[model samples]
Target: MKLEQVSETTWAIVDASTYGNVGCIKLPKSVIVIDTGMTPPLAKKFRKLIHKEVGEPITDVILTHYHSDHVFGTQVFQDCTLIASSAMAAIYPELLNNRWSPEGIQELKEYYVQNDPAFAEQLKDLRIITPTQTFEDSMTLGKENEVHIQHTGGHTAGHSTVYLNTERVLFAGDLVFCQQYPYAGDQTNNPLEWMRAFEEILKMPVEIIVPGHGPLCGKEEIQIQLAYFKKLETWIKAQLSEEISLEKVLQTVDSSPTPPYDLKADPRLKFSIERWYTFYSQDEG
Candidate 1:
């Protein structure tokens, strides 16, 4: 767990490497948390850190999206108000029943333990909680230290982001993947929608973009990710024009947006390609 003070009132807590990041800002009366960490223990650690820095109690836990990595820690902030997009709220029941059940969460924790023991230990005392407040398009909080939460659907149907109106900082959620491979698979995952979200982001008066994963970044990462998606689209279109089979497309299309990274071998990368291929192929038809 690494924390950086972006400003006197704003801070970013970056998890180990590619894990989801959390953001917090000090308001006149309380601290506003963007997202809890991936698990209870990690969220507890972040909660403690924020209390120490802000010297105030958390007033709200604003969820960026419904992904387990972002919202699974909701249990720790028990007393604080929980907030999320209406779209996310609409899907929470489904996610809880199908994806985030105790068995499902335990399986994911075990997988993480297999991959990295240190990170998985945070899964201990796991408790799942849902948002009590939700909005459709956008919402605002604070009088002096204002923050804006906007619905930006790209990564998911209900995906949203946080904007510090005064600080000019954007907690971009998964709308922008700084250095990690973007997991572009979900019932609502659409690369085009994701790109459109970026266009909207470009117009915002933001200087720093703390991505959902990877390190804290700037706008240039948005450009690079956009380029990646564009290249991916072009590659898929060319393959379709050749009348190639899906398997052949998988075989020939270069999945890596940059060199030396064999993204084709990564499961998330494969899922992303398959999802994009299916969507574009149907749209082209």
Candidate 2:
């Protein structure tokens, strides 16, 4: 993992060997973490690093969503106030009883062991720590209200973004995938809401964006992602008009117009396309 200073009071832990990206905002008396790393060990190390670099107690850990990559590491911050959108918080019980159950976790570790033994080992003592506090639409933090967390509902029904009011920086969970295609295959993913979220971000005074993945970027990346979603929506609408089957549409998506980003072979391409196609199909039906 690498830490890059974003602004006067903001910093991001980018290029994590794992998938998710996490960040922090330095406040007067304490620090607020954006998202925890992908695992307990990673988050433990991150906690230490934050203390060493910022020299302040971590008072709050704000989660952008309930994805394991972003919230799995939250175990290390159990002592702090863990926060998330009410919609996200509502999913915890189901996730805990199902995917995050001991049996389910064992299955996940076994699956990862074949591909990444190191990460699997880290999951040996894995535990799911749900948020203690929840917010409906938006919440403000800091004595001066410097941090603002808002529900955007795009990548997932409970997805959100954290904005540093004074810094003009946005911690855009999975909403903006900097240089690569995003994973939009979540069952609750909504292309229309995602597009609206992008439009809202574009109107912000944001000068810097800490994406859920990839290196730090700016509003240009948001514009690219928004345009890509618009293009995909247009294509899906045309296919629906022609009465194309969802399966056939997925098969032919590869031949559709190329995205603006150069990573055409991104593994997430097909997953995103399938989900968006399904969403549009159901809507049209």
| Best candidate, TM-score | 2
Error of 2 at 141 (Å): 0.4
Scanning candidate 1 in windows of ten residues, the lowest lDDT window is: 255-264
Give me the runs in candidate 1 sitting further than 4 Å from their true place: 15-18, 109-121, 255-266
lDDT of each: 0.79, 0.86
Candidate 2, after superposition: displacement of residue 37 in Å?
1.4
- In model 1, how large is the Cα lDDT of residue 168? 86
TM-score of structure candidate 1: 0.88
After superposition, candidate 2 runs with Cα above 4 Å error: none
- Residue lDDT tens for model 1, 76-194: 88799999999989987886787677887788789988998887787767877889998989999999537889988789888899989787889998887677777887767877778
lDDT agreement of model 1 with the native = 0.79
After the best TM-score superposition of candidate 2, give how far the Cα of residue 263 lies from its true spot, in angstroms. Answer: 2.3
TM-score of each: 0.88, 0.96
